[model samples]
Target: MADNEFQSFLTELRRGSLTLAVLGCLQESYYGYGLLQAMREKLIDIEANTLYPLLRRLESQGLLLSQWDTSESRPRKYYEISEKGRLVYKELLAEWRKMQSSIDSICGEGEEDERFN
Candidate 1:
């Protein structure tokens, strides 16, 4: 595959998981930059432009709750997963495990078959 094509495929693969990852991280409240740093620390690479839009969308979807903190010199908005987000995250996590198991089984079978051949 061309490098660009491969990158496109990789982006598509990461897109679906981004929501789940964000929701998981948002279980604890965090501001935009703080969330981005936390995700990077956990090896989940995301850009600020992408994360900011996603946070807004999740809040609009009622999956997240946000509060503005003006205690500091600069005001910052903190986000946390709402109750609905928690339920959705649980369901998504279960589905992700199921899909991962199925993929693993298929790959393992292919490896076993290759050894036999």
Candidate 2:
């Protein structure tokens, strides 16, 4: 693959996981910057530009709840996973695990003994 094509593939791959990652992280309430920092701490590396829009979309989809915290130095919008979000996260996590297992099977991972059969 050319460099640009490979980059495009990688972008598409990462885009699928962004929703899962954002939803998982919102299990605990966090403001935008705080959530960005938390994802970075987890080695996920999402940009502010990308994350803010996603947060809005999730909220609009009724998967998240948000409130403005004005008691702080600067008012910040805090987000948390709603009941619907938790259910969606659970379903997504199961689907992800199933896909991983299928990929492993295709690769014959942990099937060292079977390789000789």
Candidate 3:
């Protein structure tokens, strides 16, 4: 594949993980920028515009709670998973495992991908 095509392929991996990362990071309260930084630490190159909308969507789904923190000089909106979100996260994890097992059964276990570790 060409360089651009390969880059696009790698970008595909980012799609499936976004929701998981958002849900996982918000386990503790974090604002948009903090969540972006945390995702970067985990090697996800997510943009703020994309992430903010996603956060809003998740919040709308009753999966998250957000509150504006006015304690600091600059106020920030922090987010955390609600009880429903925790339950949803658990379901996602179970589905993810099942999906991976089904894929492995078809695709074989001998991948060089570090994600398998």
Best by lDDT: 1
Off by over 4 Å in 1: 109-117
For model 3, residues 61-90, the per-residue Cα lDDT tens digits are 999999999999999999999999999888
Q: Each candidate's lDDT (Cα)?
A: 0.95, 0.93, 0.88
Query: Candidate 1, residues 5-83: lDDT per residue as tens digits?
Result: 9988988998979999999999999999999999999999898999999999999999999999999999999999999
What residue pairs clash in candidate 2, if any at all? none
Model 3 — which ten-residue stretch has the worst lDDT? Answer: 107-116
> How high is the lDDT of residue 78 in model 3?
96
Clashing pairs in model 3?
A: none
Candidates 2 and 3, the one with greater TM-score = 2
My TM-score estimates for the predictions, one after another, are 0.89, 0.87, 0.81
Could you give the C-alpha RMSD of every candidate to the true structure, in order shown? 4.0, 4.6, 3.1
* Model 2 misplaced stretches (Cα beyond 4 Å): 108-117
Off by over 4 Å in 3: 1-13, 113-117
Better of 1 and 2 by lDDT: 1
Instruction: Output the better candidate (2/3) by lDDT.
Output: 2
Instruction: Extract clashing residue pairs from model 1.
Output: none
